[model samples]
Target: MSFTIGTREILAEPRPLPSKTVRYLVPVLSLIVGLMIGAVILLASGHDPIAAYKEVANRGFLGELPMIGTLVIATPLILTGLAAVVAFRMKIWNIGAEGQLIIGAVAASGVGLALGEHLPGWIVIVLSLLAGVAGGAFWAALAALPRAYLNTDEVISTLMLNFVALSIMNYLIFSSVSFWRDAERLTFPSGRFIADTAFLPRFWGRLHIGIFIAIGAAVLLWWILRSTKWGFEIEVTGDSGRAAAYAGIGVNRKIVSVLVVSGGLAGLAGGLEIGGVMHNLDPRALSLGVGFTGIVVAAVARLSPIGVILVAILVAGLNNSGVGLQTMGIPDDIVLLLEGIFFLCVVGGEWFLRNTIRIGVAGQPVGERSVP
Candidate 1:
């Protein structure tokens, strides 16, 4: 029997137009658009957008002590952004960064209290930070173990763990006679003061050595992701789990290890907050949406560590406008609303950057493309 053969052709796929400039331009434009829309809304609501914006700029970036407060706010964001960047780069949704941070703060507070002037200042600081790192890793293990062994949804596990961490911290401060509680102040849920030796030395202003720590972390992480073998494995795993597995890159090991490191980074942020800023571990102080905001930071920065630092500073400045908004007869939550809008626009802009919407003919695809 003979078989008839027909000509076969591989169709051409419409490639995403590569514009090195648009990679930066689109995000900047998206931000401007978001701001314009927010301003319009503010005007419609009978508020002066210009005045409000001016006050915010005056209080934040353009004010006296120019970058100090902004840097202070950006510190935790930098580390948390790194945390999200690592997990996201590996396609691991380690959403429990907040919980890990909380636990880390708790652990650091414990170490400070235990050491309490009994040890050398240097030793206390080092041990407290290490305690925070260990605490975050330990907390992350709760989710990582389940994910690695049982193939559980890390999103749910990590998110659920956040509430657990918050509840546990709250209980220790308000409902129990835990070390975190301040016996001297019976009127509130504030935590006891950590030893002064545990404090990170301040710079000229309220800024502390934590800023340097965060900058160093960004530099170190940038190097690791760009030049290391493990980083390549993570990128591969994120791109294709099956391919990574075939290449002998143990998916489970990568998942667990990366998440642990991610959590540790966030925990370091928490430790810095307690040691450098708050001077004590309070659930309220730590739950300022820093972790969630870091997600936005990671996204806005395109997952680059150095970019994360810059974006984080800008975001921190924006958030610091809460008081200024309130002064301008706008609710403090206006910043949050504007943030939500900006995040949506940037995310949508990112999608548009990577994909094109074509108005094809009736028979052709409108949004579908096939690879050659």
Candidate 2:
């Protein structure tokens, strides 16, 4: 469509499918632009942008320990990103992944404590992970049922559930004398640590097998969505619910199933954190905003399951640099600001990629066209 204001004419035309190169180029360009904008902000605030960036690179990727730390941070992000991806693909806004993760951790921790001392290490780990998954799935089902049958908005339901989940977790350890609480410590409330037998096996320095598990999940999800009938139905429903119903796809069932699966993935992330890293349901340590970061990761990856892994790693690197940035006198908020800016730029890039823009004098023909 074309419009005119004052002496200027503007045109916005729908763009065709972008070539592979263009598809890749847009995100890179957006990221570069985001960084440039951040540099400008840094300079205006009396900081050396170059040094800040260098520090970020050194702490996030250059050193072996830092690189491993980045990977460790990215472990849960991959799962949560996948969780967002699955629901977003079907146009279902499951924003409750945060709550789901908390619930998952709670259930996993419960299982670990119950089985840790009695069972073998591998069995305890397996049962704990399964409990986490089930917990997450069940939590999501609360929102999904209303969304599927009563036409409730999943976004609000899911988002609100996050607080409820957090409250429940806090109540268990902080406010009440629950089983999850460590009774030995009377001065301060603390979560009881699971037995050593429940801990996940580590491969490298502070790195566990969860990374591989996350990657495997991405691969499996990719395959399921690409090669299976269920995946086909999901894509169709996402594209158009009415059309999907016309095609005999059970839209309600798909909605519940997809969201449940998404929640399960997020739950698995919590379970892994407990088994591989925390070994306890410590609310202070668990609430790292990783679930919300997964949403950003999924968006940056354009909802591609495999793409989520790579984007999660990139985002995790930024997070890993937060502590180092502090030593350089940069506030941690700046890192979050940069992430917000980057997400905005990527979203803008998506819009530009889907439309062509042209400008000219009001009475003149659309002279030149620009494609993002």
lDDT: which candidate is best?
A: 2
Candidate that scores best on TM-score: 2
Q: Name the regions of candidate 2 deviating beyond 4 angstroms.
A: 1-10, 367-372
> What is the per-residue lDDT of model 1 for residues 154-185, given as tens digits with 9 covering 90 to 100?
99998899889999989999888887888888
Candidate 1 regions with alpha-carbon error over 4 angstroms? 1-17, 63-66, 357-372
Residues 115-209, candidate 2, lDDT per residue (tens digit)?
A: 89998999999999999999999999999999999999999999999999999998998999999999988688899999997898988789998
TM of each candidate vs. truth: 0.91, 0.95
lDDT of each: 0.85, 0.92
Report the lDDT of model 2 for residue 110.
99
- The per-prediction CA RMSD against the true structure, in angstroms, equals 6.6, 2.2
lDDT of 1: 0.85
